[model samples]
Target: MIGILILAVLAGGCRGGSDSGDSRDSGHRPAGGMMDEGTAGQLPKDGKYDPVITLTYLRPWGPDVKFQEGEDQDNNGHTRWAKDKLGIQLKNLWISPSTNNAFETKLRLSLASDAEMPDIISYRGDFNLVRELIESGKFLDAGELFDQYASDTWKDAVEEDPTVWYPYMQDGKRIGIPILDYAYNSDPVMWIREDWMMKFGFQAPKTLSDLEIIMEAFTNQDPDGNGEKDTYGLTFGFKNWVNTWMSDAGWVFGAYGTMPNQWNLTEEGKLEYGSISPGAKQALEKLQSWMGKGYLAEMAGWYDEAKAVEEFTAGRAGIVVGPHWMPAWPLADVKQKVKGARIRAYPIPSGEDGRAGRHGTSIANGVILINKDMEHPEAFFTYQNYLFDHFANPEVGSEFENGLAGENEEAIADEGDQLTNNAVHTEGYDSEKYTVTFDGARIPSLNMATLLKLAYGGKAVTPFEKKVKSGASREMLEAAEIVMVQRNIAMNQMFTGPPTETMNMNNDILSRMEKDTFSQIIYGKISIDYFDTFVEKWKAAGGDQITREVNEWYRTVNEGQ
Candidate 1:
């Protein structure tokens, strides 16, 4: 990481005249000292400022349009509305019209050129680029900026979990503001075809044995009534790390009280790598048996997430394990392919010892990096505060709802002056119709929960709460509700800090070793007895070193908190 940082800085500084005279000083300070009653720095009572400033941003998408047009900003509804209402113009430095790695190329050119940096950059992808930007020190420290300019609501959110700053932290300062997702992420659950289960006269599975029986039935019973055994029992893709554990068979290890790839604290207070645990071996044995018996998908290792879901939608597979949002995309396609296809989500099945657990990851994804030379670092917080308030109180006529009354109504108003609505519609309804409407002011990527609730028929005070309470026929909501009910049984990873020294050193070897071992065992190329050899190889390949470093990180994180 340090070497990478140095390279990025050298690359940035090599460009000439990129720095303007108004660029931020090496040291930052409050805009106008402490605000007093007479000071202009004080927030206006009317929530409006006379000398509004404009900031340019390089973002992933375009201004809001009736139909999306590549990565152009024309489809970005929120950016346009921000310019209109707040008197803040958010100009796009560039837009990429292609999806296949073209946007990343443009961003790379921007970084390598001598042009001045944009006031802000909202990245949707390319982790490597973000790392380079951080290494350059062109981005301001989000922690200090937040403290100086953030509104009360934004401050509270950042304080909710200090780990939110992990991704953007270089040395000790935070270079970016992370995008917050759920409080506890890693709650993967099994999504089963409800219609198939009923057709086969099987009950919802409660234990690992029960799951095996159900899967066997799905594979052999011809629940689709096609009178042929062409369908599979389960579906999953193992192409990426996200799909490997958090989305697919990762929960299988959870049932054995092992969360693979996570640094877990043992009863003895030692940090242990979950993947090399004895329990993980047990879970692998179970998976091996399932594969040999043809209960698992044959293309598990080859399929990406989309392809994996296709098997389910094509009615060739009966079960999939993923996050709560699975229904919104791949699973929802089942409705078009199979009439009366009903999928039901449930907690991961219990193991032989009655242990049921799911792994949890960090809530924040990446950081929002700001240009250090910006005139108003605090303005970013002010913008975020507005979004937060809207998230908290997403009423029909709220400012976030495109200035249209009852447009994104999650619920109807039964009475006046009430904080809640009686019924809610998903975000794109028009006059109780189910047509997909677009909101130029909507921030869907940042507030998916709110969008989902409006798509459903529930209402609450905030987007988070609404997602917790909202119930609709939508598959995603149903899956979320199921996971929410069993959150207590989930095991959140204790070590979510950046990859440690040993981890960085051995990451490639360990990942390949795990994948190969699991694949070989499942495919009957190696016996379950070989599990011990794999463990030994893991330790020899820096697993032991990783364990030590992970513990150290755990100690440091807890000590400071």
Candidate 2:
């Protein structure tokens, strides 16, 4: 399940969108935006289509997105730029708000009814839907089109992690172009209460035993100074899944060498279910011990990710694990509640072997498909190329950085001495999200690498770097440094393709059973040996067949590569 990632900064500002004087054509080839003479019917020189080209797509409108009084989805600043600057016209076939999965429902119905398909589709959720679209035979070979039309920058970005193409591959042809995003965006790091650490005279944990000692102190020592036994050592939610984006307990399993709820590669180079591994049993034993010592919250089994984080934010827990972005979010609430409260990010504690591992994030968040019957297929590439070249990482003091001519001065003035001049959206408008694809465009690893550079005393000379420096806090910089230092240990999920037949039939039942049994063992309602019985039952209930199917899919994809 890949959720759409909202970029921290708007990728494109209001620079070229409003200034391009080119006019739209009533026909396919308009007189305003044209190609060079004698190059007719061929790829254009500067991505300008010459005669205007119309690319149609369905719009998944966001509830939070606002439009200027005179502008709309069809006549916004971004759409104007496509018409005048790039000689492309974006046509929305229909509009559907994103709430309640409205867009996905419409698309599914379209597929089932064989409705007229748009020229291109930018989908950002559900790999299963992507697979269904590809299997429908309504889309073209995206790899072929990309190779033939994509700019060097676009090609290089996709090549950064070639595995991004795995999910969209069919019959040895890549049928979808992945929408790239920053890597390691959700990998876990340790966040500890600095005031509590100082009160307890503790240092950063270097090993699992060290972490345990800190947890015990936090649980029993009343680190909050309220003189009540209400605080816990560490906080995480395990009700939905052990491994998750927030309030994650994957590090706990990582401490023992496996991450539950994600497929991991074994020593023999075959994919295996992490929940059934020997390391998982060992991890369960350790969790049971922690439960006995009351080191974890008593409400863990009932808490989801949001509920679990409240344990830390309400100042009832001393530690929480999450991504580097925590300081900018719910974690910041602690400062307003606890006087003189200080929080800091640190590396995940090593296990007994002096090593650690945690769940890794994917670089590509969504898939973009092209309809086989569409005319002007290359126009999509041209529009995306322009976005990647300019807005992906805008140059300092450029029009993109300066924004609209009038608003530029005020936006720059707000930076103070930093001279951060990134463009600001017009009131009631965000031009980036109004483009053909959500969040406009991005280059994988660019944003994080820039943060890492600033984290270690590197200069912020570029606009992108300055933007990062202006937005990131000292704690976030330090967290980025810690994240990079532990990058090698990230255990990325290996089975990215759609679920297999056995998985479709038995996954829900197996997942419930696993969660129930694990929680029972941790709560002491069942003996640790019950794990052995659970594993045997899991195999009998289709876990073995699912493993075989996953490996077979893995082998086929790898062999295709």
Candidate 3:
């Protein structure tokens, strides 16, 4: 999980040149205004359509950050292009500079006040906020609207897996649109320092025993060649949920053929909780032994997701486990921190039982919510459908790359253009000759995996893309490509649906039980003999109810699909 924390301020006030035309005619209408039917249907016939409509948005990412004018490739690029090409202006009603607490605070304030709710709320924060928004009854049922008005492309996406709609559905009606991504939602791989491995003459670990040997060597052999045995074997941040632990540690459990926080069907065809299974006990025992040997990070519990990556960046640890995108941002900082440092990624090591599998959390954070009072929900759907067809797919040149320098040469006009900006001229850098040459190329479409690849010398059209592309080395690219290939072997857990009635009501007790049992087992405060006692207490603390509800949801989802 990406740690929900406040980010540092990079730039000051907005720096881009403002649009100076008449404000009223620029498609950005004030709240509570209407567009005529003639204006709604007046899109360009060449498939380059811009419907003039103003929509307010609530974003989890902050407002102060500007979309890179000529070179940035991201969601912000998509939004900006929509304004330029489609005349659909999206204005932020509120922006959370900090992701976790700050985001929650602003959302609550918005809900409490009677101020007009935004046309769209693309939430990517706490699940608790999701539940609150759904219960508020202020949002329109987007599921029903989607079925009625969604484009064929959008419908195909939703129909492929009914579970995609789970986060938005309420009483069988959809209330939000989910932003989709391919791999990061589930699969996690091991990232290693390749330069250190080469120095120490070690290969990437393939099995549990192999991993142990490597970890021991990493700890004792002084892989860094600093002559100081201060380096630890593996490091990860684990604080909030078992899922966070399972995100990285689950690969170890997979060696034993069990996945935590899930219900695995037995040979008898009975669904059983993985955490309570005997396999889990064995996995925990292994982790405990490793902890006892000081192979794992000592302060893992105190660190959050962001800080865990810092360990590897600081050169205090050798291996970090995360999704394929780790090389792009968090892990990419290693080269700056340590001269000539090279990071490589490998598949999760196979377990002791010869089983190498991955456990995936099928659920995403939340879905896009529409204000109940908003009259043009269909327009938003149309806009998103266009985005899906153009940006997400490989067939269309993205709007973000339109009319910019180097775009015509580097971008494949037929295939969707990459989000690399190629503009060399900044606002005031070269004024005289390039005065009217301000290139406003759109950003590229990027998911976590592609971003990682692009970071490591892959070609992209946007200038920002080029910057990141230049940062990564050949070794990094090879490692990222390898991990990308292994993504299919990962197992997406069948049950990531919401909690059942009893479990939801007793969540506090259930959470307490999980924390107490796991902490006690790890600290040796309770013997492994107490495992059975913990199981019984877990059921009493609402585990049993959770199982039944989860199974029911699973059955419903499969049946619908």
Candidate 1's C-alpha runs over 4 A off are 1-52, 62-77, 112-115, 124-128, 184-186, 241-247, 395-397, 401-471, 474-478
Better of 1 and 3 by lDDT: 1
How are the candidates ranked when ordered by lDDT, highest leading?
Answer: 2, 1, 3
lDDT string, candidate 1, 1-561, tens digits = 212222342334211111322211111222322233433453454343445657676655422222224422432344444544444555666655336677678877877885678888766466667777887878878778677665444454455566767766788888877765444334577889999988878887889999898988888888888889898788877666422533377678878887776666678887787877898888888887888888878877778777787888888899988777666556788978999999888777889888877776455654578998887655555555555444333434344332222333344333232232222333432221110111111221223343334344544444333333443346666565566556666666677666677766788889899888877877789988898998899888898888777787778767876
* Model number with the top TM-score: 2
Please say which candidate is ahead in lDDT: 2 or 3.
Answer: 2
TM-score of 3: 0.76
Ranking by TM-score: 2, 1, 3
Measured by C-alpha RMSD in angstroms, how accurate is candidate 2? 6.1
> Which portions of model 3 miss their true places by more than 4 Å?
1-52, 67-84, 112-115, 184-186, 245-247, 263-271, 361-365, 394-399, 402-481
Best by lDDT: 2
- Give the TM-scores of the predictions, in the order they appear: 0.78, 0.86, 0.76
- Cα error of candidate 1 at position 333, Å: 1.7
Q: What local lDDT score does residue 346 receive in model 3, on the 0 to 100 scale?
A: 81
lDDT of 1 at 548: 77
Give stretches of model 2 more than 4 Å off: 1-46, 62-75, 402-410, 413-430
Candidate 2 lDDT, 144-173, residue by residue in tens: 877766665566667767889878888778
Clash count in backbone of candidate 3:
14
